[model samples]
Target: MTEQPARWTEATVYPDMWADPDDDPRNSEGPSPDGELGSLQDYLTNYRLTLRMKCEGLDAEQLARRSVPPSTMSLLGLVRHLAEVERHWRTWLTEDEPLPKLYGKRDADFDGAVAEPAVVEASFRDLEREQAATDAALAGYADLGERVGKDGVAIRELLVHRIEEYARHCGHADLLRECVDGRVGQ
Candidate 1:
């Protein structure tokens, strides 16, 4: 692992502490209107945003740096992988038939992840776009009990799963970001 700077600066500080008011979901003071589903969505959204915040201001090399040796996973790769994941889940939930995978190869996400600025920017953009689409698709369903997904999974289950996925990745992001610059916390 490369040594990180010991001091913190505006560029190295965690962004979540000073995030835009509109994006600060945790600042809200009450239960969500839609109950469990809304809570899950809120958690997922915040976690995803936090992941992005963790990578903010980092250059392509830093973003593409793997925290541990022998692992191809990087922040850029995670963003790309999550974009594909969000698309896959949304398509499965919305359609009656099983849709083909976005990347034909199951490991295409990691395979395509590279240490390039354009690729990193594109991956982040794809993630934001897919996230927006997934949010819109989820907005129409009021009943969390409604069945979605090809295997007849309940909407609530899927929602919870999304939250879990984001939470898990957020942890990874924290470690990766710290490894890059030594900044930590939400």
Candidate 2:
């Protein structure tokens, strides 16, 4: 019987990861934003890119692979969930009437993350579209201190919260990617 080969990307570099650190695409090199808003945006941008990088070079099945039993936190699910999050935030900030939830209800984003190419492509598209829309909405606010949404949450707080959410999810992405193919890095 023939053994199955590992599902890994080509050009593995280091034990943890093959790609050179300096050449890593996730590096948003150069001076970071000095002001609070710039700083928040920078962090958010990097986290978003990091998540996408982690999911790269993977097929639909790998993207939708669940972490452990009873948990449906797949890479594809994360993308979909974040899309819903971005859409929700943008709606809250821009509209007097909140639009309907993207995935309908809680956890549907994860639950519906089946291993299908169309689904995977749609997840990425939705995430990117929502992220752009959210950023555009954020740009309208000159001051982070200014509040938005029905709950009256400040833009500063919302940006920070989004960064925090991405940070947490990126950590999860690292673990999930490692488990999927033994490839690991920041």
Most accurate candidate by lDDT = 2
Writing each residue's lDDT as its tens digit, candidate 2 over 26-53 gives 5666887898887888789889988988
Any runs in candidate 2 off by more than 4 Å, and if so which?
1-18
Worst 10-residue stretch by lDDT in candidate 2? 2-11
Q: What pairs collide in candidate 2?
A: 13-18, 14-17, 14-18
lDDT of 1 by residue, 1-186 (tens): 546655343333345343445555455766565867656877887788778788888898888887777887788778888888888778657556645555558777766777898888788888888888888887888898999665777878778878888888888887888778877656
What are the TM-scores, per candidate, against the unseen true structure? 0.81, 0.88
Cα lDDT, model 2, residue 136: 87
